[model samples]
Target chain A: GAGVSQTPSNKVTEKGKYVELRCDPISGHTALYWYRQSLGQGPEFLIYFQGTGAADDSGLPNDRFFAVRPEGSVSTLKIQRTERGDSAVYLCASSFGLGADTQYFGPGTRLTVL
Target chain B: TQLLEQSPQFLSIQEGENLTVYCNSSSVFSSLQWYRQEPGEGPVLLVTVVTGGEVKKLKRLTFQFGDARKDSSLHITAAQPGDTGLYLCAGALRSNDYKLSFGAGTTVTVRA
Candidate 1:
């Protein structure tokens, strides 16, 4: 793909509902990342993947938020018992090979929890 | 945890005016990047600074990385109405972790 892609551009769920967001990184990119952005704020790091495994999950807000990249090409972010506070734009990015390189971003999925 | 702080959460200026946005941090970074975002779209990369005290120019924009690598600034000369958007600064952790910490961002609205 020419750039990173995200699925379900917008999502609306009730409180306590579960939701899944998908991310497809650019071809040949070996690094992927997930970020969450609240209104009027910058994107906040959520997790990072180097390959099939997650390299860093420390940024996840809590256990309620989980992300996985089983094949290293596409990733999914799962949120359980969604809260109103979780309403924000979930962003995904990918870099050629990682290691502090520039990252290309996707359009992002806007998740609204009502 | 490394944190980047951007000043003037919101800025509005007239066309032909000049402005500078600042990004400050307490921790040094291996590299820093600047981005511009518009409504309903993802952020687009503007420039990246790797070496300390380095400056890069892109047309009417000038980006500078502080000597300490903990701060950066973006200066725009003779801004135009098209420059109205959100300006963001993100940093690459110095530990080679590949994690990017982004500043809160500065919303600039350049009016004609």
Candidate 2:
């Protein structure tokens, strides 16, 4: 792909419902990341992938959140039992390398869990 | 926990005026990056400063990294209405770490 692409640009769901946001990173991008940005706040690191496996999932808030990049090119963020506080914009970024390189971000998916 | 704090959470000025936004943190960073975001759009990278005491210029925008690598600033010369947007600062906790810690951001509005 020309750039990082995210799916379901907007998702609205009720509390307790599960939601999944997808990201399609640039071709051959080995590093994928997921972040959450709330109103009036910067993007917070949610998870990071070095390849097909998660190298750093420390940023995940709790067990309810999970992300996976099966092929190292596309990723998915899953939220179980969504809550109102889960409302925010989820951002996906990809870089050619794990360090020192700039990250290209997608348009983001706005999730509103009512 | 490492954190970046941006000052003057909101700034509004008339066109042609100059403005500066600061990002401060207690911990040092291997690299710091600045981004500008508009409403309904993702943040766009403006510049990245890696070494301490480094300065870079992009047209009217100037970025400076502190000597201690714990702070950075973004200065705009002859600001325009187009410069109005949310400015963010992101830093890495460790050398070559992919994870970034970002500041809450500074919102600037330049009146036409």
Q: Best by TM-score, which number?
A: 2
Q: Estimated TM-score per prediction?
A: 0.95, 0.97
The DockQ values of the predictions, listed in order, are 0.74, 0.80
Measure candidate 2: CA RMSD: 1.1
User: Against the hidden true structure, what lDDT does model 2 obtain?
Assistant: 0.93
Ten contiguous residues minimizing lDDT sum, candidate 1 chain A: A95-104
Q: Give the TM-score of candidate 2.
A: 0.97
**lDDT for each residue of candidate 2 in B25-88, tens digit (9 for 90 to 100):** 9999999999998887788899999899999999999999999999999999999999999999
Stretches > 4 Å off in candidate 1: none
Instruction: Report the lDDT tens digits of candidate 1 across residue range B1-112.
Output: 3399999899999999999999999988889999999987789999999999999999999999999999999999999999999999999877465778899899999999
Interface RMSD of 2: 0.9
lDDT of 2 at A8: 94
lDDT score, residue B21, model 1? 98
Candidate 2, residues A1-114, lDDT tens digits: the string is: 698899999999999999999999989889999999999999999998989999999989999999988877789999999989999999999989877678888989999988
Window of ten residues with lowest summed lDDT in model 2 chain A: A95-104
